[model samples]
Target chain A: MALELLKERWSSAINVLKVGAVKEEGGTRASAITVGGQTTLPFLLDEGGMPHRPVVAMEIFDVAPLEWPVSLLEPFGDAVKDPVKWAKKCINEFKADLICLTLKGTHPEAENISADKAVELVKNMLKEISTPLIIIGSGDKEKDNDVLARCSQATKGENCLFGLAAQDNFKTLVASCMADDHCIIADSPIDINIAKQVNILITDMGFKPEKIAMHPSTAALGYGMEYVYSIMERSRLAAFVGDKMLAMPFIIFVGQEAWKVKEAAANVADEPGWGDERMRGPLWEAATAVAMLHAGADILVMRHPEAVATVKRSIDSMMKGNND
Target chain B: MLVIGELINGMYQNVEQAIKTKNRSIIHKLAKEQLEAGADMLDINAGPHGADPKETMRWLIETIREVTPAPLAIDSTKLDVVELGLKLAGEGSMINSTKADDEKLDIYVPLAKKYKAKLIGLTMDKKGVPRDKNVKCELAAKILAKCMEMDLPLEDVYIDPIVLPVNVAQAQCAELLDVLREFKLISDPPPQTVVGLSNVSQGTKQRSLINRTYLVMAVASGLSGAIVDPLDKELMDAMITAELLLNKNIYCDSYIDAYRKR
Candidate 1:
């Protein structure tokens, strides 16, 4: 008797989203990246098609970090002090596919920079690095509305991806992205229904579905990571089963979530049983990224040079259909 | 669940008056309201309204198509009326039904295939509705076999295991649910299952309550579609909750709102 492989066919495919546009297409990036468009579940090529491999976006802040551990701050050296140097080092040395510029300095409790200052930093970052940018606002909702609108206008035609548009605060981001020809990140708090609802609300505001990405908020390893993993799995399954509202590509913040956990951030002397802090931290981040990739993450906003290399290699191997 | 809005049928007095006067506004309003309430398809029936059934069907379809392109179920007992509606409504329409008999299948099966329309097969013959669950399954198997022999894709076939009013045939209600469960076993990729949901509550005082409770139970028994009044908010909410509980949809606090939007 011959072996008969059972294959499940899906009725729909995930929508493909382009992150950036090159100069000929009215953007200054050297090249653009396309993600999503998977006809099957992640890395299961025997059943269907996964046309594009998942890409990594390295995270940078507009202002220097005051809380990063020694293991994390050591890799960037003095580049951490300057956003342009940090972005260039990420693209030139670490080969990051994208740069996620978080405007944390604009928060009221932080440096409390004005929208003008945020726009200046964005302009400087765009001038230095030809890589695509993912610009996000500070956590302050009222301040983000003002700062992101200014930044979005300053980066018109660049087609950068903007972030953190939740259910309650998506109108401003939607209008900005609509006017600027950029993509948006629709965030939900680990609930698949809210995830879909946020997408619906954004689309209702006339933002094109192809220009939207879903951010089901991330969780680190051993700290409710499975919740996020399962949510992404269920979401991808829903998209494959022809739920148009949930059919957008997923963009997860692996570095931001993973690095905040004690397993990845605690000092080695504090927990002797857990190996060295340097190796343990990067491995924790790398494991989280790989797990998310398997759960159908199309774009991972990651940090740590070593973790980025590991995840990139893993994506290459997975795309090659290697089972070993 | 594939909710087929049951408001456009001439059996309703309002629809009968609309069909009699050729009132496009009345029919158009019903179509829009049902769709807005989340009907995946519309069921158009020209009941005994003393008008030319073919003309009434054509007028209903044309009026509704002007408002929206939602799929229509060309519902009628007359073969000529069904054939005319099928021709005018174009592809993606459904034959509201045919009895599980060779004579009826021979005509409806070919017409459905030629028109690229779905065919709904009721599990009953000229002898009348089956009293036992096994007999209903036997009739369903006959319908499935006929569809297979005639080269129609089973995916386009919906097996309706005839629901009777609880006031008249109370014993058959449970049996019909069993038949729905058994219908899946008759084929590899089972044919879709549907029910005329309002039939179960005829002459009942608590019509909405009965209809919704029975709908949830039928959904649990693998009912894939229902012909119901989508405007009934409570009934539609029950259907949405049942699907969510079955893991057919992901849960959020505002799932009812989400389903209506979808």
Candidate 2:
């Protein structure tokens, strides 16, 4: 039997975004980070060029988490309460590429912190860390609109990545990002159509496409990971075939979703086979991140320092000989 | 889809008047309106109303140039008028057409190379408008062969399988779509395909309805561009919705506006 070689050709490519603008480019940071611009599937080094490596962003909170699993809480120790110190630990100790400062305290059901308080906390975090910031607000639509707008104003020209501009509550956040010249995260609930629609709506307002990232909601391994997997795959495929709306770099909320799954951190006192919850949680998070990387995730928001390290090691290894 | 707006052609009453009087305002207004209505390029034909089409084409090019930098389609059967339009319209101008036959291609095909302009090649030959898919496909292949021999890039070449009037050539309508689908197989990197879209609806009472429905069918068959009226709102909407359904454009709730923006 004779084997004939046939190569697949792609008409379009995903757009690369240089997210955090440094001082020379009008932002205060010393460095900028670029993501996306993959012509082929992720880590398929032989297929095409992956111009930028996938970077890890460790999620920090404006207020301390009261319900974090014991496995997650043990690492931060006392630094969890203060946002600045928490951001510093992600950068200084854990070597996170970016810090995603989520204002979880501003949720109406939670602490219900005012916009000013959230802004103030952000200002403090900015003063403390030089790693690029991805500022996200509480999931509550009304509260996020009020809080994120103020936060955007405080970080004007800093070129921070602000996000979760969902379908129902995008206007205020989009306006804030536009006015401040910051990047936006277009979020959808694991649906490609919704993801594409949100992107189009934002771009229709004259928002630059490169100043956007996609957040197709993620689920952890052994917990509907297939849904997240396929959505991301379809999104990247569409982008490769020249769908501009879905071409932005993907930002998977790895830490939040992966940790939330029972397989990652569930206390297994009843089942002897579920052994060693400590190692299991972070390992689950890492495995989930690795699979997502293969499925075209461009940014990973992760917790569990060990999990972050494991993901980082894998990225470094995969990215080592990527020249085609 | 590449929309070459048809409104600027002097066959229209307003354009005819603009050509005769050399009234830059009337011509510029038409050019600006068509551009705003989402035309990628404007077809500047001085029509039968012009005493000297070459002078009229030059006038239109000069007037439109003052307002916008959108590319112009140098539309004329006369080589001199087409050449003058190209001269004034500059680098990105498109030759509105040439037939597959040697008599037309000998002149117009080289003009595309000389000026580095995009060329549109018609499927009809000396025998006249193609009667069926076989003739259309055969003519397209002949044009592709000519383009190759002349060292012309197929990427810049557009194959136009002429759209006949539905009221007359009803039997040929379905076959035209088949020709459009088969055009890609003529070359590895297929030449782009466009059609004179309104011709499909000529003499029909439901002109807009037939034109749009046929345009969508053409689009589904891999037609890449068309010379049509951008100002036709329903027609433009149908084209955009078809593109979205065909996955040519990304989906958005406000996709119509977004498609225009893109």
What is the Å distance of residue B49 in model 1 from its true position? 4.6
Q: List the residue pairs that clash in candidate 1.
A: none
| Candidates in order, interface RMSD in Å | 2.3, 2.3
Residues A1-324 of candidate 2: C-alpha lDDT, one tens digit per residue? 899766555777888887777788877776888999888888877677799999999998888886888988899999998888888988999999999989898999998999989988888877778878999988898888888899999989888999889888799999999999999999998888888889888887878999999998988898888898998888788778767777899999889988898777776684458877789899999999999999899889999999999999999989985422
Scored by lDDT, model 2 comes in at: 0.87
Number of clashes recorded per candidate? 0, 0
lDDT of 2 at B6: 93
**TM-score of each candidate?**
0.88, 0.88
Give the Å shift of residue B85 in candidate 1: 3.4
Model 1 error, position A84 (Å): 1.4
B21, model 1: CA deviation in Å?
A: 5.2
- Report the Cα lDDT for residue A41, model 1: 93
TM-score of decoy 1: 0.88
RMSD of 2: 3.4
Expressed as tens digits, the lDDT of each residue in B93-165 for candidate 2 is: 8998899998788788788999989999998887888576777888999988888888778888999988889
Model 1 misplaced regions, further than 4 Å? A21-32, A66-71, A167-182, A200-210, A261-283, B12-26, B49-59, B181-191, B203-206
